[model samples]
Target chain A: MKISARNQLPGTVRATTMGAVMAEVTVDVDAGAIVAAITRGSAESLELKVGDKVTVLIKATEVMIAK
Target chain B: MKISARNQLPGTVRATTMGAVMAEVTVDVDAGAIVAAITRGSAESLELKVGDKVTVLIKATEVMIAK
Candidate 1:
Protein backbone atom coordinates (compact mmCIF):
# COMPACT_ATOMS: atom_id res chain seq x y z
CA MET A 1 0.00 0.00 0.00
CA LYS A 2 1.27 3.49 -0.84
CA ILE A 3 0.41 6.77 0.87
CA SER A 4 1.25 10.18 -0.53
CA ALA A 5 0.18 13.78 0.08
CA ARG A 6 0.63 17.14 -1.63
CA ASN A 7 2.91 18.99 0.80
CA GLN A 8 3.34 19.07 4.52
CA LEU A 9 0.76 20.46 6.90
CA PRO A 10 1.54 21.09 10.55
CA GLY A 11 -0.63 19.63 13.28
CA THR A 12 -0.64 18.17 16.75
CA VAL A 13 -2.05 14.67 16.94
CA ARG A 14 -3.85 13.31 19.97
CA ALA A 15 -4.98 9.78 20.59
CA THR A 16 -8.70 9.44 20.94
CA THR A 17 -11.04 6.70 22.06
CA MET A 18 -10.79 3.40 20.26
CA GLY A 19 -12.95 2.78 17.27
CA ALA A 20 -14.89 -0.39 16.55
CA VAL A 21 -11.65 -2.26 15.92
CA MET A 22 -8.78 0.18 16.30
CA ALA A 23 -7.85 3.42 18.01
CA GLU A 24 -8.49 6.81 16.46
CA VAL A 25 -5.93 9.49 15.53
CA THR A 26 -7.18 13.00 16.05
CA VAL A 27 -5.02 15.70 14.52
CA ASP A 28 -5.64 19.35 15.27
CA VAL A 29 -4.53 21.31 12.18
CA ASP A 30 -3.17 24.29 14.10
CA ALA A 31 -4.38 26.77 11.51
CA GLY A 32 -7.92 25.54 11.97
CA ALA A 33 -7.79 24.58 8.31
CA ILE A 34 -8.83 21.15 9.47
CA VAL A 35 -10.70 21.93 12.64
CA ALA A 36 -11.62 18.34 13.51
CA ALA A 37 -10.19 15.01 12.39
CA ILE A 38 -10.45 11.28 12.89
CA THR A 39 -8.53 8.46 11.26
CA ARG A 40 -8.50 4.72 11.71
CA GLY A 41 -5.89 2.12 12.67
CA SER A 42 -3.55 2.65 9.76
CA ALA A 43 -2.83 6.30 10.43
CA GLU A 44 -2.55 5.66 14.14
CA SER A 45 -0.18 2.75 13.71
CA LEU A 46 1.96 5.06 11.63
CA GLU A 47 2.69 6.64 15.01
CA LEU A 48 1.33 10.05 14.25
CA LYS A 49 3.09 12.18 16.79
CA VAL A 50 1.98 15.42 18.32
CA GLY A 51 3.31 18.54 16.61
CA ASP A 52 4.20 16.47 13.60
CA LYS A 53 4.07 17.41 9.98
CA VAL A 54 2.13 15.00 7.79
CA THR A 55 0.59 15.06 4.38
CA VAL A 56 -3.04 14.36 3.64
CA LEU A 57 -3.72 13.27 0.10
CA ILE A 58 -7.26 13.45 -1.24
CA LYS A 59 -7.76 11.76 -4.59
CA ALA A 60 -11.05 12.18 -6.45
CA THR A 61 -12.09 13.07 -9.94
CA GLU A 62 -14.10 16.01 -8.75
CA VAL A 63 -11.16 17.94 -7.37
CA MET A 64 -10.88 20.76 -9.84
CA ILE A 65 -7.93 23.11 -10.04
CA ALA A 66 -9.78 26.20 -10.98
CA LYS A 67 -8.03 29.41 -11.81
CA MET B 1 -19.02 10.60 11.08
CA LYS B 2 -18.76 12.42 7.80
CA ILE B 3 -17.54 11.65 4.26
CA SER B 4 -16.96 14.43 1.80
CA ALA B 5 -15.06 14.74 -1.51
CA ARG B 6 -13.99 17.81 -3.40
CA ASN B 7 -16.26 17.03 -6.37
CA GLN B 8 -17.67 14.07 -8.24
CA LEU B 9 -15.13 11.84 -9.95
CA PRO B 10 -16.27 9.44 -12.61
CA GLY B 11 -15.40 5.82 -12.08
CA THR B 12 -16.59 2.24 -12.42
CA VAL B 13 -16.55 0.54 -9.08
CA ARG B 14 -15.88 -3.16 -9.08
CA ALA B 15 -16.05 -5.24 -5.95
CA THR B 16 -12.69 -6.73 -5.16
CA THR B 17 -11.88 -9.42 -2.64
CA MET B 18 -12.86 -8.71 0.94
CA GLY B 19 -10.36 -6.82 3.04
CA ALA B 20 -8.94 -7.91 6.37
CA VAL B 21 -11.98 -6.55 8.25
CA MET B 22 -14.27 -5.36 5.50
CA ALA B 23 -14.70 -5.53 1.74
CA GLU B 24 -12.62 -3.29 -0.50
CA VAL B 25 -14.07 -0.73 -2.88
CA THR B 26 -12.07 -0.73 -6.10
CA VAL B 27 -13.06 2.02 -8.43
CA ASP B 28 -11.51 2.31 -11.85
CA VAL B 29 -11.24 6.02 -12.38
CA ASP B 30 -11.89 5.66 -16.09
CA ALA B 31 -10.02 8.82 -16.85
CA GLY B 32 -6.86 7.18 -15.62
CA ALA B 33 -6.28 10.17 -13.40
CA ILE B 34 -6.51 7.99 -10.36
CA VAL B 35 -5.15 5.09 -12.45
CA ALA B 36 -5.45 2.65 -9.53
CA ALA B 37 -7.70 2.99 -6.49
CA ILE B 38 -8.65 1.15 -3.36
CA THR B 39 -10.97 2.21 -0.60
CA ARG B 40 -12.16 0.53 2.56
CA GLY B 41 -15.51 -1.03 3.38
CA SER B 42 -17.27 2.26 4.00
CA ALA B 43 -17.14 3.28 0.36
CA GLU B 44 -18.55 -0.04 -0.75
CA SER B 45 -21.34 -0.08 1.84
CA LEU B 46 -22.25 3.34 0.59
CA GLU B 47 -23.70 1.42 -2.36
CA LEU B 48 -21.14 2.72 -4.81
CA LYS B 49 -22.72 1.69 -8.08
CA VAL B 50 -20.83 0.90 -11.25
CA GLY B 51 -20.19 3.96 -13.40
CA ASP B 52 -21.13 6.25 -10.60
CA LYS B 53 -19.94 9.64 -9.49
CA VAL B 54 -18.30 9.62 -6.07
CA THR B 55 -16.19 12.04 -4.17
CA VAL B 56 -13.11 10.86 -2.30
CA LEU B 57 -12.03 13.04 0.57
CA ILE B 58 -8.53 12.58 1.96
CA LYS B 59 -7.73 14.69 4.99
CA ALA B 60 -4.17 14.89 6.23
CA THR B 61 -1.87 17.59 7.52
CA GLU B 62 0.31 17.63 4.40
CA VAL B 63 -1.87 19.04 1.65
CA MET B 64 -0.15 22.13 0.24
CA ILE B 65 -2.00 24.32 -2.28
CA ALA B 66 0.61 26.21 -4.21
CA LYS B 67 -0.55 29.20 -6.13
Candidate 2:
Protein backbone atom coordinates (compact mmCIF):
# COMPACT_ATOMS: atom_id res chain seq x y z
CA MET A 1 0.00 0.00 0.00
CA LYS A 2 1.20 3.49 -0.72
CA ILE A 3 1.70 5.51 2.43
CA SER A 4 2.85 9.05 2.93
CA ALA A 5 5.98 9.18 5.02
CA ARG A 6 5.19 12.76 5.90
CA ASN A 7 2.64 13.51 8.52
CA GLN A 8 0.72 15.63 6.02
CA LEU A 9 -2.62 14.24 4.96
CA PRO A 10 -5.31 15.71 2.75
CA GLY A 11 -8.92 16.01 3.88
CA THR A 12 -11.96 18.16 3.37
CA VAL A 13 -12.90 20.71 5.96
CA ARG A 14 -16.28 19.82 7.35
CA ALA A 15 -16.59 22.55 9.95
CA THR A 16 -14.64 25.12 11.91
CA THR A 17 -14.88 26.90 15.22
CA MET A 18 -13.07 30.08 16.11
CA GLY A 19 -11.81 31.21 19.49
CA ALA A 20 -9.65 34.11 20.58
CA VAL A 21 -6.37 32.31 20.03
CA MET A 22 -7.08 28.78 18.82
CA ALA A 23 -9.16 27.54 15.93
CA GLU A 24 -10.30 24.02 15.17
CA VAL A 25 -11.49 22.35 12.01
CA THR A 26 -13.76 19.36 11.78
CA VAL A 27 -12.02 17.63 8.90
CA ASP A 28 -13.85 14.95 6.97
CA VAL A 29 -11.89 11.89 5.99
CA ASP A 30 -13.02 8.89 4.05
CA ALA A 31 -11.81 6.59 6.82
CA GLY A 32 -9.49 8.25 9.39
CA ALA A 33 -9.04 11.18 11.72
CA ILE A 34 -6.55 13.36 13.57
CA VAL A 35 -7.19 16.00 16.21
CA ALA A 36 -4.95 19.00 15.73
CA ALA A 37 -4.35 22.46 17.11
CA ILE A 38 -3.57 25.39 14.84
CA THR A 39 -3.06 29.10 14.97
CA ARG A 40 -6.38 30.66 15.97
CA GLY A 41 -6.08 33.13 13.12
CA SER A 42 -5.84 30.30 10.59
CA ALA A 43 -9.51 29.48 11.17
CA GLU A 44 -10.40 32.97 10.06
CA SER A 45 -7.65 33.88 7.65
CA LEU A 46 -8.07 30.71 5.61
CA GLU A 47 -11.82 31.08 5.45
CA LEU A 48 -12.15 27.34 5.93
CA LYS A 49 -14.82 26.28 3.51
CA VAL A 50 -17.18 23.54 4.49
CA GLY A 51 -16.20 21.44 1.51
CA ASP A 52 -12.77 22.80 0.92
CA LYS A 53 -10.04 20.19 0.77
CA VAL A 54 -6.99 20.97 2.86
CA THR A 55 -3.98 19.27 4.33
CA VAL A 56 -3.63 18.11 7.93
CA LEU A 57 0.00 17.93 8.99
CA ILE A 58 1.09 17.00 12.47
CA LYS A 59 4.29 16.03 14.19
CA ALA A 60 4.39 12.68 15.94
CA THR A 61 5.12 14.41 19.20
CA GLU A 62 1.85 16.25 18.96
CA VAL A 63 -0.07 13.11 18.15
CA MET A 64 -1.06 10.79 20.98
CA ILE A 65 -2.65 7.69 19.59
CA ALA A 66 -4.83 5.67 21.94
CA LYS A 67 -4.72 2.37 20.20
CA MET B 1 -26.27 21.84 2.48
CA LYS B 2 -26.41 18.73 4.59
CA ILE B 3 -25.19 19.18 8.11
CA SER B 4 -25.24 16.90 11.11
CA ALA B 5 -27.05 18.67 13.90
CA ARG B 6 -25.87 15.96 16.20
CA ASN B 7 -22.26 17.05 15.73
CA GLN B 8 -21.19 13.73 14.28
CA LEU B 9 -18.46 13.72 11.63
CA PRO B 10 -16.68 11.02 9.67
CA GLY B 11 -12.93 10.60 9.65
CA THR B 12 -10.14 8.05 9.54
CA VAL B 13 -8.37 7.12 12.74
CA ARG B 14 -4.71 7.86 12.14
CA ALA B 15 -3.56 7.06 15.67
CA THR B 16 -4.76 6.56 19.24
CA THR B 17 -3.11 7.21 22.58
CA MET B 18 -3.97 5.39 25.75
CA GLY B 19 -4.02 7.05 29.10
CA ALA B 20 -5.23 5.89 32.50
CA VAL B 21 -8.77 7.04 31.85
CA MET B 22 -8.95 8.84 28.54
CA ALA B 23 -7.95 7.96 24.99
CA GLU B 24 -7.23 10.53 22.35
CA VAL B 25 -7.82 9.96 18.66
CA THR B 26 -5.66 11.52 16.04
CA VAL B 27 -8.30 11.55 13.37
CA ASP B 28 -7.41 12.35 9.78
CA VAL B 29 -9.53 14.80 7.86
CA ASP B 30 -9.07 16.56 4.58
CA ALA B 31 -9.02 20.11 5.86
CA GLY B 32 -10.68 20.47 9.23
CA ALA B 33 -10.14 18.70 12.55
CA ILE B 34 -11.65 17.99 15.95
CA VAL B 35 -9.84 16.67 19.03
CA ALA B 36 -11.79 14.08 20.92
CA ALA B 37 -11.19 12.19 24.15
CA ILE B 38 -12.76 8.84 24.66
CA THR B 39 -12.55 5.86 26.99
CA ARG B 40 -9.02 4.50 27.09
CA GLY B 41 -10.25 0.98 26.69
CA SER B 42 -12.19 1.92 23.61
CA ALA B 43 -8.93 2.53 21.84
CA GLU B 44 -7.97 -1.08 22.32
CA SER B 45 -11.43 -2.54 21.76
CA LEU B 46 -12.04 -0.48 18.66
CA GLU B 47 -8.75 -1.52 17.12
CA LEU B 48 -8.54 1.77 15.31
CA LYS B 49 -6.64 0.99 12.15
CA VAL B 50 -4.48 3.61 10.56
CA GLY B 51 -6.88 3.78 7.65
CA ASP B 52 -10.07 2.86 9.42
CA LYS B 53 -13.04 5.10 8.91
CA VAL B 54 -14.76 6.20 12.09
CA THR B 55 -17.27 8.72 13.25
CA VAL B 56 -16.43 11.52 15.63
CA LEU B 57 -19.29 12.75 17.76
CA ILE B 58 -18.64 15.91 19.68
CA LYS B 59 -20.75 17.89 22.04
CA ALA B 60 -20.41 21.56 21.28
CA THR B 61 -20.09 22.45 24.92
CA GLU B 62 -16.97 20.35 25.15
CA VAL B 63 -15.42 22.22 22.22
CA MET B 64 -13.55 25.40 22.83
CA ILE B 65 -13.13 27.20 19.52
CA ALA B 66 -10.22 29.56 19.30
CA LYS B 67 -10.35 32.21 16.65
Candidate 3:
Protein backbone atom coordinates (compact mmCIF):
# COMPACT_ATOMS: atom_id res chain seq x y z
CA MET A 1 0.00 0.00 0.00
CA LYS A 2 1.10 3.55 -0.67
CA ILE A 3 2.15 5.39 2.47
CA SER A 4 2.67 9.06 3.28
CA ALA A 5 5.88 8.59 5.25
CA ARG A 6 8.67 10.41 3.38
CA ASN A 7 11.65 8.33 4.43
CA GLN A 8 12.13 5.04 2.59
CA LEU A 9 15.51 3.31 2.71
CA PRO A 10 16.33 0.15 0.82
CA GLY A 11 18.59 -2.12 2.82
CA THR A 12 19.48 -5.60 3.87
CA VAL A 13 18.45 -7.15 7.15
CA ARG A 14 21.59 -7.23 9.26
CA ALA A 15 20.11 -8.81 12.33
CA THR A 16 16.87 -9.71 14.09
CA THR A 17 16.15 -9.80 17.80
CA MET A 18 12.81 -11.21 18.88
CA GLY A 19 11.08 -10.54 22.16
CA ALA A 20 7.81 -11.69 23.70
CA VAL A 21 5.65 -8.98 22.18
CA MET A 22 8.10 -6.94 20.12
CA ALA A 23 10.95 -7.54 17.73
CA GLU A 24 13.97 -5.48 16.73
CA VAL A 25 15.32 -5.68 13.21
CA THR A 26 18.50 -3.96 12.14
CA VAL A 27 18.87 -3.06 8.49
CA ASP A 28 22.07 -2.08 6.72
CA VAL A 29 21.35 0.87 4.44
CA ASP A 30 23.76 2.95 2.46
CA ALA A 31 23.47 5.78 4.94
CA GLY A 32 23.82 3.50 7.97
CA ALA A 33 22.17 0.81 9.99
CA ILE A 34 18.52 1.52 10.79
CA VAL A 35 16.88 -0.28 13.69
CA ALA A 36 13.14 -0.97 13.69
CA ALA A 37 10.89 -2.18 16.47
CA ILE A 38 7.82 -3.93 15.12
CA THR A 39 5.19 -6.11 16.71
CA ARG A 40 6.09 -9.78 16.96
CA GLY A 41 3.03 -10.52 14.86
CA SER A 42 4.22 -8.29 12.03
CA ALA A 43 7.74 -9.62 12.29
CA GLU A 44 6.53 -13.18 12.08
CA SER A 45 4.13 -12.33 9.31
CA LEU A 46 6.95 -10.88 7.27
CA GLU A 47 9.13 -13.87 8.01
CA LEU A 48 12.10 -11.55 8.23
CA LYS A 49 15.52 -13.17 8.11
CA VAL A 50 19.07 -11.88 8.08
CA GLY A 51 20.30 -10.83 4.64
CA ASP A 52 16.79 -10.28 3.34
CA LYS A 53 16.28 -7.22 1.19
CA VAL A 54 13.80 -4.73 2.55
CA THR A 55 12.79 -1.12 2.66
CA VAL A 56 12.40 0.74 5.93
CA LEU A 57 9.43 3.07 6.21
CA ILE A 58 8.73 5.78 8.81
CA LYS A 59 5.71 7.96 9.16
CA ALA A 60 6.02 11.73 9.29
CA THR A 61 4.31 11.97 12.66
CA GLU A 62 6.71 9.47 14.11
CA VAL A 63 9.63 11.73 13.16
CA MET A 64 11.01 14.35 15.54
CA ILE A 65 13.61 16.97 14.86
CA ALA A 66 15.57 18.27 17.83
CA LYS A 67 17.00 21.70 17.49
CA MET B 1 15.63 12.74 27.02
CA LYS B 2 17.48 9.72 25.72
CA ILE B 3 15.55 7.77 23.10
CA SER B 4 15.86 4.26 21.67
CA ALA B 5 15.12 5.27 18.06
CA ARG B 6 18.45 4.81 16.28
CA ASN B 7 18.09 7.08 13.25
CA GLN B 8 19.28 10.60 14.06
CA LEU B 9 19.69 12.98 11.15
CA PRO B 10 20.95 16.52 11.43
CA GLY B 11 19.17 18.93 9.11
CA THR B 12 17.66 22.34 8.55
CA VAL B 13 13.97 23.12 8.79
CA ARG B 14 12.91 23.72 5.21
CA ALA B 15 9.31 24.50 5.97
CA THR B 16 6.39 23.95 8.35
CA THR B 17 2.64 23.69 7.82
CA MET B 18 0.45 23.96 10.90
CA GLY B 19 -3.15 22.92 11.29
CA ALA B 20 -5.57 22.90 14.19
CA VAL B 21 -4.45 19.58 15.58
CA MET B 22 -1.44 18.50 13.53
CA ALA B 23 1.57 20.02 11.82
CA GLU B 24 3.83 18.89 9.05
CA VAL B 25 7.52 19.75 9.21
CA THR B 26 9.97 19.37 6.38
CA VAL B 27 13.65 19.09 7.20
CA ASP B 28 16.43 19.07 4.66
CA VAL B 29 18.91 16.44 5.78
CA ASP B 30 22.08 15.36 4.02
CA ALA B 31 20.25 12.46 2.47
CA GLY B 32 17.16 14.43 1.46
CA ALA B 33 14.08 16.16 2.77
CA ILE B 34 12.62 14.34 5.77
CA VAL B 35 9.00 15.15 6.58
CA ALA B 36 7.56 14.91 10.07
CA ALA B 37 3.98 15.02 11.23
CA ILE B 38 3.70 16.22 14.81
CA THR B 39 1.02 17.56 17.09
CA ARG B 40 0.32 21.24 16.78
CA GLY B 41 1.20 21.50 20.45
CA SER B 42 4.65 20.10 19.73
CA ALA B 43 5.10 22.33 16.70
CA GLU B 44 4.25 25.34 18.84
CA SER B 45 6.42 24.10 21.66
CA LEU B 46 9.42 23.80 19.40
CA GLU B 47 8.76 27.14 17.76
CA LEU B 48 10.11 25.68 14.57
CA LYS B 49 10.99 28.27 11.97
CA VAL B 50 12.39 28.04 8.52
CA GLY B 51 16.16 27.64 8.25
CA ASP B 52 16.41 26.40 11.83
CA LYS B 53 18.86 23.59 12.50
CA VAL B 54 17.42 20.42 13.95
CA THR B 55 18.02 16.73 14.38
CA VAL B 56 15.34 14.36 13.20
CA LEU B 57 14.46 11.57 15.62
CA ILE B 58 12.48 8.41 14.88
CA LYS B 59 11.54 5.58 17.17
CA ALA B 60 12.29 2.05 16.17
CA THR B 61 8.73 1.04 16.83
CA GLU B 62 7.50 3.71 14.48
CA VAL B 63 9.63 2.31 11.70
CA MET B 64 8.55 -0.42 9.31
CA ILE B 65 10.46 -2.50 6.81
CA ALA B 66 8.77 -3.90 3.71
CA LYS B 67 10.19 -6.74 1.72
Binned by DockQ into CAPRI classes (incorrect, acceptable, medium, high), candidate 2 is: incorrect
The best candidate by DockQ is 3
- Candidate 1 per-residue lDDT over residues A25-60, each given as its tens digit: 445665554322334566566766655665544445
Candidate 3 residue pairs in backbone clash: A37-B60, A60-B37
lDDT of 1 at B42: 45
lDDT tens digits, residues B1-66, model 2?
443333455667877668898776777654455455666776668776567787655433233222
Which ten residues in a row are the worst by lDDT in model 1 chain A? A30-39
lDDT of 1 by residue, B1-67 (tens): 4344333455665544443333445566655534223333344567655566655444333245878
Off by over 4 Å in 1: A1-6, A15-26, A31-67, B1-9, B16-24, B28-35, B38-67
Query: Residue A24: error of model 1 in Å?
Result: 8.1
Residue range B9-67, candidate 3, lDDT tens digits = 78899999999999999998766678998898988998999999998888787899899
lDDT of 2: 0.55
Q: Rate residue A50 of model 3 by lDDT.
A: 99
Candidate 3, residues A1-67: lDDT per residue as tens digits?
8876688878899999999999999998766678899998898999999999999898787898787
Interface DockQ per candidate: 0.05, 0.07, 0.68
Q: Write the number of the candidate with greater lDDT, choosing between 1 and 2.
A: 2
Worst 10 residues of 3 chain A by lDDT: A1-10
Best by lDDT: 3
